[model samples]
Target: MGSITLTNIQKSYGAVHVLHDINLAINEGEFIVFVGPSGCGKSTLLRVIAGLEKVTGGELSINGERVNDVSAADRGLAMVFQSYALYPHMTVRQNLAFGLENAGMPKAEITQRIGEAARMLEIEQYMDRRPGQLSGGQRQRVAIGRAIVRRPTAFLLDEPLSNLDAELRVSTRAEIAALHARLRSTMIYVTHDQVEAMTLANRIVVMRAGRIEQVGTPLDLYNQPANRFVAGFIGAPHMNFIEGALESSNGTHMLRTAQGDVLHLPQSVAPGAPITVGLRPQHISLSNDQSGFAAQVQLVEALGSETVIHASAFGTKLLAIVPGQRRISTGDTIYLSYANAPLHLFDQSGLRIATVQTEDGHSPTFV
Candidate 1:
């Protein structure tokens, strides 16, 4: 196992900078996930860690040793890319043992490693088949198996589940998670899928436009985002933001909506300031008795375990998540209420002003 540390790390192509001033410490045997949209420098950062891309500045250390100028092979990290990157003509067994053979391991050692990895990965059944003969999930398992045989200090996975179908992706994701639990090796995975990030990561690194926005545990980021972007980006249905006037003149913070409605904030908010009222779909509950803010349902999405109600509130679209097939309808007028405190509060600059927890704080995440 190995630990990874990045201090003020940066990357660029020509004059365009892609990653800037990244400082992170990844503990040995931790499963770290880098998640963001396309062109967000996630892959670029991963490549830099693998020594596949040169760092323009700053420091990168693996196992307490600087490897900025080291060759990819010398880094002793195995990278599993989105593309399977397997030898098409070779059998799975051949592919898994090829690297060891090339490294001049004895034939016995190569065979032993291959057998052990296959048993660990449960791909022994397909070991003799070519990549073409296996299903997509099986093929992916073979690719992972190939990397496993190397037994590197760290494993770098770049969207390895993207190529699989939805069902296969689910099973394969669980397999990967279980693999980490069993192997207990340091693994860094990159993906644009927040579901993958939320489920697989011990720590999720949220990035935007070439820089890291925030890093936290799944629920920590979900419950208390650092900014508006982090709040909206990390959730599945995303968070609902209603433009309103912030008022804290009374003992409690309240927001007056544009359509002549006032919603009480869960935490203290600065008075008489312009702020966006953010309520996640899950936090908003529906009441037919008109107890809260009035909204007209616009659409309904049923997902078996929960129903999502999309409505227009104070002239802005709002989403409310109701538990278990709520049997809601379109064009139905309903009242909404915030189910919790700790609402995400952000300044005009998009940085969080403070959490609902305190009267004064710089970032919501600091709570």
Candidate 2:
């Protein structure tokens, strides 16, 4: 009953176009997250689905029924917002009952729903407290409880954790995950925080400038990004891009960086063609010997179990994450290598190109 589909959905604000040709299919009981940078139209798309914003074009369907003309109140969807949006004067129990009371639900049913939701959210003790009397996390839970009592077709959360402290965000995130597991209901969450999207989503929708970039499982987006943007956006500390030009000699391909460091290319490309070499920070390791290129350390973060190093290489900034503690410091010269590690290749247009390594350890073949 929670299935949703968007067909060529587009949104515009008078002269400014926001969303562009968005097409997606969301299945029942799926937890989908929409994520992107600010002004990326993620929230706008969510509002469109919630029936708060009118679409400029195309169709929106929920449970195989076209809902483009439906009002937000009639859409059978409950939305939890970032601001906790609770009535300051009303107690938690009253807040949870407000919607049901307006819908002409029986008092007994409203009481039953409120009791169940409060207990499920572990907020039974705070049922009589006003929102102003509770902590941020408690208030957020009350907000969720309010939505839970509705038993809506699906849930829509718009950066609901953005207002909490870091520690509270973590704990509340866990609770939300558990709630979803218990309910197994469709949930569409929107957030600019990639960490939240990564931890909570069954499938993530990557958006940019109002257009959907890529939609996939968390690991799928991490292990196999569709383009340079997705590769850079999906990972922590992001991927490092080194500018280089492809060179060919004796039928062997190589990439020569702007800093004059040469790396063997597993695939062939047009000689002197501009390309970008992408390597994740975790994939790079500090070389004990001089087998790799030298980089000047810019900063060091010794994070107990692992160290994050910011260095300069290939005429650009580089970041390398290594395991355990090291005596490395700023201004120190270090050798780095990524031999046999997975590499991402992008052409002049920033599109990904496939590369296959040979068993005999020769240059990679382009498929």
Candidate 3:
């Protein structure tokens, strides 16, 4: 296992800068996932770490040594790609043995490593098959097995599961997690799927528009986002947003939505300030009563375990995840309320204000 540090790392393609002030320190044996929308530069950052993309500026240190000028083959990192990238004509055994062969290892050593990797990946039965004869999941296992045989200090996976089926995706996710636990090596995963990021990473890095927005564990990013974008991006059904204005007290907030209704809050907030209130779908409690915000059900999706209720409220559509067998139909009026503890408040500028008091007993604030 080895630690990785990126200081002021940057990338550009002639005038369009893709990464800015990218500073991060990853501990040995830690699994860090990079997540963002397409064109957000997640894959680019992983390539930078693997020494595949040349950084226009900044320092990269691997295992305490600067590796900005190191070649990809010498970085002691193995990369697995979405396409599997296996040679079509080579057997599974050959695919795993190719890299070690290039390094001029003994034939006995290469054979031993390939045997161990095939056993670990449960592909012993397919050792003689070429990429053309194997299924998608099998091919991916071969790709991972090739990485394992190298015994690299760090493993870099760039959407390695994107090509698999949904069911296969889940199975491979578990396998990857188990692989990490067994190897205990530093790993970096880049993907646009939040589920992959949340399930695999010990910590998550949320990026947007070529910049890092927040760095935290899965629950940290879920419960406490650093900005509006992070808050909206990390949640499953996405957080509900309500436009409002500053109320009577410094912390108290009120909303007069376009649906011709008013909402009063107990917390103190600045008056006359335009703000946005965010609440997760799971945080909301739906009821038949009209006391809280009233909504007309627009659509209802019933999964086996839970139901998703899409309703029209305050002149906008809102989604509520109703747990367990409860069902609602379209055009049904429903009430929505949730605890304030999970409520998110964003300023007019889209920045987050601290909701808790400071350690010195001062009021907690984001401003």
Error of 2 at 147 (Å): 1.1
Residue 145, candidate 1: Cα error in Å is 0.7
Per-model TM against the reference: 0.93, 0.96, 0.94
**Among all candidates shown, the one with the greatest lDDT:** 2
Q: Name the regions of candidate 3 deviating beyond 4 angstroms.
A: 249-252, 258-260, 354-367
Error of 1 at 168 (Å): 1.5
Would you list the C-alpha lDDT of every candidate in the order shown?
0.85, 0.89, 0.85
Q: lDDT by residue for model 3 over 55-139, one digit each (tens)?
A: 9999999999999999999999999997989999999888999999999999999999999999899999999999999999999
lDDT of 2 by residue, 289-327 (tens): 875778999999999999999999888999999999999
What is the clash tally of candidate 1? Answer: 1
- lDDT-superior candidate, 1 or 2: 2
TM-score-best of 2 and 3: 2
- Rate residue 45 of model 3 by lDDT: 94
In angstroms, give how far residue 116 of model 2 lies from its true place.
0.4
Positional deviation of residue 252's Cα in model 3 after best superposition, in angstroms: 5.2
Model 1 residue 76 distance off true place after TM-score fit, in angstroms: 0.8
Report clash pairs, candidate 2: 266-364
